[model samples]
Target: MITVSNLTKRYGSVHALGPVDLEIPRGGVTALIGPNGAGKSTMLTIIGRLLSGDSGRVEVGDLDVVTADSRELAKKLAILRQENHFVARLTVRQLVGLGRFPHSRGRMRPDDVEAVDLALEFLDLTPLQDRFLDELSGGQRQRAYVAMVLAQQTDYVLLDEPLNNLDMRHAVTMMRQLRRAADELGRTVVVVVHDVNFAAAYADLVVAMVDGRIAHVGPAREVITPYVLTEVFGTPVDVIEHRDRPVAVYYH
Candidate 1:
């Protein structure tokens, strides 16, 4: 499980995040949803240990996120930020192999190679394994980045806006893959997603943030309603049952 106690971040006098307390259970997908500048990414980056909070503590399972050894923590949690920039010209396989650095230390062992291959296959990037990242489409490159995170084989995975640049079909595929990782591999998946419908369909829990605070957190059916959606997004939203799931219709 992941626990946050009074987590807060500030940019000088501006409150970017909160003195928010949250508990995320183990072995399921939790979707963090909110409008722009709502601090969804801030909270995820803090939990993933990529960003620091002014006050509060975060623990991933038994490891203290703030104090845990960097190499050791890398083995426990893997994070994919919203923007990915590759400085070196690298192929899909090479990028995914970077995930094994904690274990392999830049020397690729047989097990590391196997792990990378498995992740590539999982993301259906095996066919493009030799291709350079710049050669792939935006959606394809996003898949490659996700594949790298999966190759880490960590118990906890945190992704920010993973559906960015993806078409509807690829977006659904990515969500399903994350769902499988949680259901079959017993990994804890926390993703920052904008679409309420996708969260409703795939996530076990939905966390809504507003003005750097967690507005609501509950099951999809409970959290993605018209009233909650309207309040969180500051727009009129209609929830309709589709295939027994709540789908948000918020178009103007």
Candidate 2:
């Protein structure tokens, strides 16, 4: 389980995030949703150890995120941030290999190569693995970055706006893959999504954030209701039931 306690981030006089506490269980997909400046990205980045929290603690399983050795933490958790800047010229394969650095210490073993291959296959990037990152389409590049994170083969996965730039088909495929990863592989999956309907459809749990704090956290059904969603997003959202699931409708 991932435990967060009184986490906070501040920038000058602005409190960007937290004074928040949350518990994420093992082996399920959880989606975090919120409006602009809601601190969703800040919390996700802090949990992933990509950004430092001004105060408070985050522990993934037993590893203390604040002080744990980063190399060791890489073995326990893998994260994909919202912004990825790869100015250096590198092939998709080489970039994916970097995920194995923690386990292989920069010298990839055969198993590590196999892991890279599997991740490429998982993201349907085996065909583009030889291509330079800058040469791929936006969605393809996003898949490649996600594949790199998956190749790390950690127990916990945190993704920030992973569906960005993905077509409908790819986004559906990615969510299904994440579900399978949770159910079949027993990995914990946490994703930040702008589309509440996607979170409604794919996540076992929905964590709604607003104005630097958690507005709601519960099973998908409980949080996806019109009342809760409308309350969280501060807009009237119509809820429609389809195929035994609740889908939020915000468009007029």
List candidate 1 stretches off by more than 4 Å: none
Please provide TM-scores, in order, for all candidate models, with all chains considered together.
Answer: 0.98, 0.96
Worst 10 residues of 1 by lDDT: 82-91
**lDDT winner:** 1
| lDDT of each candidate versus the true structure | 0.94, 0.91
Output the worst ten-in-a-row residue range by lDDT, candidate 2. Answer: 178-187
Q: For model 1, what is the C-alpha lDDT against the true structure?
A: 0.94
Each prediction's Cα RMSD? 0.9, 1.2
Q: Candidate 1 lDDT, tens digit per residue, 112-223?
A: 9999999999889999999999999998899999998989989999999999878999999999999998998788999999888999999999999999999999999999
lDDT score for residue 151 of model 1 = 91
lDDT of 1 at 172: 96
